[model samples]
Target: MHRIVIAFLLSSLSGLAFAHGMSAEDQARILNAGLLEYMQLGATHMLSGYDHLLFLFGVVFFLTRFKDILKFITAFTVGHSITLIVATLLEISANYYLIDAVIALTVCYKAFDNLDGFKRYFQMSSPNLTWMVFAFGLIHGFGLSTRLQQLPLGTDGLVLKILSFNVGVELGQIVALSIMLVILAGWRKTASFERFSKASNIGLMLFGGLLLLMQLHGYQHTQFPDEFPLNTDDHFHIHEDMEAETSPLTNYPNKLNFDDIYSQDEVLHDDNSYQDEHSHDGEDFHSH
Candidate 1:
């Protein structure tokens, strides 16, 4: 059972590992990418977003009715869509690591709620689940916006691009939810699932906490940029030093530029000597 939980986490995080970079090809595609391509990109991003998936999973973990699932999912969708489109259009930027860290905590929050942690530990009624999901959906949308803005979304047809992306996001959500529903269906049939449901939520909570810690670690490195040696321009400096040490390109022994090859006095003397040589050559040619 623990092995199953670990395998699930590893699979989800693998996609997350490549989520943000927006490869050179992806960036180029965004410049001229059509509605369909933008839509595909959106779907791809949502599918790869493990935090979003985990939160959705936590939300639906106990939901048995289709109508309830739709209602909750719709609320989440509306909340995120409002923020995703508005924040993106307004070009509102936030620190991505901080935003993502909050998103990670959202998963933990949901899992904790699923496990009745609030009632057990805090001795308080849990907040309205619907409203809370919607609110966190807004935050999740902002996180999506941050990632989208990394692309060179052109000024023209911006609204269309955003809409297409949103459409793709919905498609991706549907695909992911379908799979979760199938799995949940199969698992709910088993006696083990009844016994391990709490353990499963606990696993979710732990994974979410792990993700949160990773994001915070990233945030700290971002805040103190100097500590991360890889970010510094040390590589360029080293290349320059290597050239200076081992290459004549830095010294330019064969450089043709006047400033590099000739002193002012050398230029003047060369000019005078050239005239003298020309006079001597002319005399010799006439005499011959």
Candidate 2:
């Protein structure tokens, strides 16, 4: 089935994030990370990152000019790369599970655009989906950095490591886009192009929608650092608990089920166990 193929593709990318591919014994080597490794990681993540690739594909899917694509890509690159580096440098990062969940939603956004969801729903053009995609790119960049940090590569070349990874990402993206452009152009040359265009975009939108929904309920209690009390840097630290408004299912609903779910260790332990199972899957789907 189509879902199987897409699932396989995503799993293939995540598999490449294995730290075992490097050296586990070199944990002490702070300067061990090199250009070659970052290059490999960058290229690997870009291609393997089904969500990221789909986002980029959606962003440039409409633009027909090289310069325009570069401009758009540049905006997105800057937005995300800034946060990615800062996350590692200042140790300021968002919840890993939540960010990824949002990235999945972005894929759905693009697919929805392809299917003309916006026009049918909002019927507006001034504030389009491009800006939304760019904002999501910021989150996506952090997602990339998070995966990179998980690797054993020495942080000594932290700057270089991040930079090299960014470059490799762009390189890989160019390669993917080039092929896609060729296919689109060729398709345009055909007579049935117009007939199939809507369907193709719809397929992309459908894929995006599926990714979005998958990530929303990925974890039952999407806990992260909360920005309540100020930190030593005079800046509030918003760790895993930053998503307060949206995580009612985990926090609010629990208040309602305080007796049933969180009544005692015997009850709470089982509830935690169930949540852990859902969190491990890292995606959620609930019936309204």
Candidate 3:
């Protein structure tokens, strides 16, 4: 049991690095992908989305009745689906790091609610949990939309692509929920569960807090790249090098060209900088 716990912790820590971002290879492969491929991508995203899974776990932690489970889960599904489809279709977006930070908070919120923190600490009742779950689901869907936008989603068949991805997310959620329910059901029968449920929720909160901090740290790096000792270009290159070192396809002859990806990004950044500089110069001349 100790070994299992340690192993799980190690895996989770490592997974944090790759969470919520697709690899360059994945992006490249999906450039001209069809609906089936989009569905696969969506399924893969949900499976790897630890924050989403944690929130779902907290939601169903104490729910034993199938009716209650179906109701809450359906509410969550409808909520996220509405945002996921609408946001992506309208091309509405925000900083993904910030969105994910909020999502991490949702995980913490659910876990805290699970522990009856409101009644214990504040002598008050918790808010309507079903409504809260639905609200958080909207935020979660926006987070998903942000990630999906990173791909080259073409205008052709856009609605179909989005629907396919949403369907895949539901499928992935079903699979994850089944496994969680089975585990919870078995654990509930054990004496250890009575002793450890509180501890488990506390652990969930800690994990959520950790994820929140990491996302904020990433946001800092992205928004204030100049504050770091390394220039933005150098920092990104270092990241690319690290990815290459860790990638299993490092020696593969047909590996995707990460340099090309960076080069394209550099071009776009330079163009934006050029336009901004000229615009500022124009304003200065007019002011004078």
Best by lDDT: 1
Using lDDT as the yardstick, the better of models 1 and 2 is: 1
TM-score of 3: 0.77
List RMSD in Å for every model shown.
8.1, 21.7, 21.0
Off by over 4 Å in 2: 1-31, 126-130, 153-155, 216-218, 221-288
Candidate 1, 1-288: lDDT as tens digits: 434544666788666566453577889878878999999999998888999999999999889999999989998999989999999999997988899999999999999999998899999999999999999999999998988898999899999999999999999999989988777877777787778899888888888898899889889888997777764487888887888899857677766677745587788776766553334655653211
Compared with the true structure, model 1 gives a TM-score of 0.78
For 148-253, candidate 3 gives per-residue lDDT tens digits of 8888888889999999999989988998789788778877887777777787778878988999999999899889977776877988999999999999877888
Could you tell which candidate, 1 or 2, scores higher by TM-score?
1
Q: What is the lDDT of candidate 1?
A: 0.86
The local distance difference test score of each candidate is 0.86, 0.64, 0.85
Listed in order, each prediction's TM-score against the native is 0.78, 0.62, 0.77
Q: What TM-score does structure 2 among the candidates reach?
A: 0.62
Residue 218, model 2, lDDT: 44
Estimate the overall C-alpha local distance difference test score of candidate 3. Answer: 0.85
